[model samples]
Target: MWRRVTSLSHLLSSPKSSPQLTPTSYGPKIWETLSTEVSKKSGGGIFSKERSPFITFVLGGPGSGKGTQCSRIVETYGFTHLSAGDLLRKEITMNSENGAMILDTIAKGKIVPSEVTIKLIRKAIESAENDKFLIDGFPRTEENRIAYERIIGAEPNIVLFFDCPEEVMVKRVLSRNEGRVDDNIDTVKERLKAFRSLNLPVINHYSNKGVLYKIDGTGTEDEIFERVRAVFDAWK
Candidate 1:
């Protein structure tokens, strides 16, 4: 199972403090949360410019290995990967009533209310220590995109879509051993259905606007990552 790069509790304890980016005990299969001793150029670590900072949104259906690819990018390039789902899941683990409700909602494969999700996105972006980012498993709706535009004040410079077949996704999810409540077949099916019925349009909108790039996701993990690497390496 892939655990979070680190516990946010550790980060929150010393807020505004840069702890340290230790060598990751977990392998390269996960995003390694990192902190630096020195404050970077910008207080938030993500630079503020007249236009948007360098950012990319990773979009894909379940089992398309979006998380795996994000991990790879964080390792090879110096981009921070912010997963909206992981942050919400951590809130659940905190065991507050809020956490419990979020955990239950996540397991059900429904979207968390937009305000709740947007609040989280704002905080995560503000805490970043890196300018480049690969945000995964997010903007699952047109509403999600609009909220980001309204709150983050910038849209993504690039959007990467991992295009995989439904059959392949089903088999991959069934075999995925993370033990995530949402990884179950029933939830997987519902999520997929919801993604196609609801989320594909957001993807298409980006594609039409010339900001979308598609990578073939039918191959092995290494093969899929190679495609993502090409897209990101060419990032300006």
Candidate 2:
């Protein structure tokens, strides 16, 4: 995991202070507690316009290799890749009260509550020093999209959809061997179904907004990333 050293906690500790991008090892539970305490003390939300980051939301099915390509993009383009799934998994490891629920949700291939997932992403954004971000596996539902916009008060500058076939995605997931809770065949099917029923609309929303760049996610990682590179290059 790429991490930046920041002093955001010190800033948030003060009731009237605005958040300054700072890295902290505090878990999501601590961050949420701090945020709620701060909100009550300050009588306002934690977000501010000064914290607006140039975000790219990466959308894809169960096994579209978004994670793999995101690493390459981070290396090549200097963007922070914040994987929502990874964040949730970390919460489980931290023995959070929501851990069992998140584990069950992932095993069933259902989306975690939007608020829970967004809080993790929000903390990541606040702590990172980089302005460019690739937010992976987020906004999996319409509610997720709405909650993120309402809470974060910003939209993604670009949305990258890895358009891959269902069969291809299944194969990739089966072969992934990543020890993820949702990597089994049954879970993959459920995830694909969720992607179609829930995630597709989010993609379409971005498509209509004209910030969506659909990449043919069928070839080698390098080949697919070439197409991805072209899209980001044009954006630059």
State which candidate has the highest TM-score.
Answer: 2
Which one is best on lDDT? 2
Question: lDDT of all the models against the reference?
Answer: 0.69, 0.76
Q: Candidate 1: misplaced stretches above 4 Å? A: 1-52
Point out the worst 10-residue segment of candidate 1 by lDDT: 31-40
Instruction: Report how far off residue 43 is in candidate 1 (Å).
Output: 17
My TM-score estimates for the predictions, one after another, are 0.76, 0.79
lDDT of 2 by residue, 1-236 (tens): 22222312221123222222323454536534533443443343334323335678999998888999999999998999999999999999998989999988888888899999999998887788886899999989989999988887666767877878899999999997988888999989999998989997797787677566677788799988887776665444
Deviating ranges (above 4 Å) for candidate 2:
1-49
Q: How do the residues 43-108 of candidate 1 rate in per-residue lDDT, one tens digit apiece?
A: 332334321246678888999888888899899887888888888887887876578778878788
